[model samples]
Target: MSKHSVVIFVSQRNSLRSILAQACLAHLGSGRFLALSCGWPGMLADAIHPAAIGALNSASMPIPNHRPRDWNDLARPSAARAEFVITLDETTSSFQPRWPGQPDSALWAFPDVAAAGDPEKVAHLAIQMLYALRRRLELFVSLPLQGTDRAAIRSDLRDLAHMR
Candidate 1:
């Protein structure tokens, strides 16, 4: 199997979606893939998003004290180049991004309704989006390199979700 590393960029580290993806990818496909998350140029290292951390913990995937990082640190010599970069934002330009190795990238718009705010509203907004992402992403990352069958991949995704 080919090793794939993805650089996931977000506006801030203190949030539901970005950390959720990082933890989920790391937990689900740890050996097969390398996953890291960053933010725009000056985003600070801060506490993990409360709602997000809770969401992940409830799902048995808690990730704590995630530091916000930038492309400079990432592009440093020792870091591996990301083969794919995915930006998660509801608006296209809400965050700054630079794709390494001219990698394939997509601006996936997702609701940040779980930002620092009231618990009920955030849960209603953020966790809902997380479920949606979990469904689509299972199918996405399951793609094989050559002659991969779409129907089989879908079945696999369904089974994987059930297992989760």
Candidate 2:
């Protein structure tokens, strides 16, 4: 049987881009990939942004039930070892934590939708981010992971970061 990869999408706050990526991957990757997400310590929110939830709902994606988590929480010895770690914002991309198993990492930078000052603008950005993330994830799930080496997988992921 082929191995199922655990991928963690990380960001500064885990309220927008990372949350969208996690939901998109979980729904799209299904049996092939397990999706998780986290943010920097002390940056977690009580809940994900409402715009994020609305975006997922519009796309018919599954909404995550849990609150935001700190990256340190996932770094624990007992935590599920991630095979892939992707950062979705500049802050998180600059702060590298030693993930368990030294997961193949990539920086898929996306704008912070939660930072939009207007509610309508926030919702619009969230939808845009959702579409962008879904496009990348669609390509991600189609990769020949079972046959590809770690280096190739890492390269492919980084290449996706360049996609709009």
Candidate 3:
């Protein structure tokens, strides 16, 4: 099996969706993939969202102790390398950073759960995003990365991002 690395980015506030995706992918990939997350430059929280932790815990997935990282944090040589870079938000032009390699990239923008409601509602949205992303990550880890099917893989990634 070809092991791949991925970076998940959300334009701002790595505290929520991006961190959730990073933790979920780490478990969902089951060693076939390595994942990390980063956000736009800004004051970062020391802890991730309580609802993010809750969703992962409720699903029995390992809750990662993630500190919100900025774009520069991801550019460090010691940072995990990425073969794929998935943006969890649409404002890529606003904060995209150069990585060591030109990783295949895609945007998977889900509703900003933090912007939409109370803590309870945010937790619900987190689970919803988790369920959707889990399916995609499963498929991603199963793909033949060594083969010349990159176009198909990219297409599949885009299609998966649009799932409800």
- Candidates arranged by TM-score, highest first: 2, 3, 1
In angstroms, the error of model 1 at 118 is: 1.4
TM-scores, in order shown? 0.73, 0.96, 0.87
Question: In order, what lDDT does every prediction score?
Answer: 0.58, 0.88, 0.74
- What value of lDDT does candidate 1 attain over all alpha carbons? 0.58
RMSD (Å) per prediction: 5.7, 1.3, 2.2
TM-score winner between candidates 2 and 3: 2
lDDT of 1 by residue, 1-164 (tens): 24564545454443556677776777666456677766555554455666776677667865835565655666555667775556675443444545445555555566667554788778666666666666656655666733566456435533443322
Number of clashing pairs per prediction, in order: 0, 0, 0
- What's the lDDT for residue 49 in model 1? 65
Candidate 3 lDDT, 28-130, residue by residue in tens: 7767677778777764667788888888888888876658878787777777767777888776535687776667788888667877668889889888877
Record all residue pairs in model 2 with backbone atoms less than 3 Å apart, i.e. clashing.
Answer: none
The residue-by-residue lDDT of candidate 2 on 1-164, one tens digit each, is 13778999998988888899999999998678889999998877778999999999999998987799899988888888998899998777777578888888998888777877899999998999899999999999998888678798889999999996
Global local distance difference test of model 2: 0.88
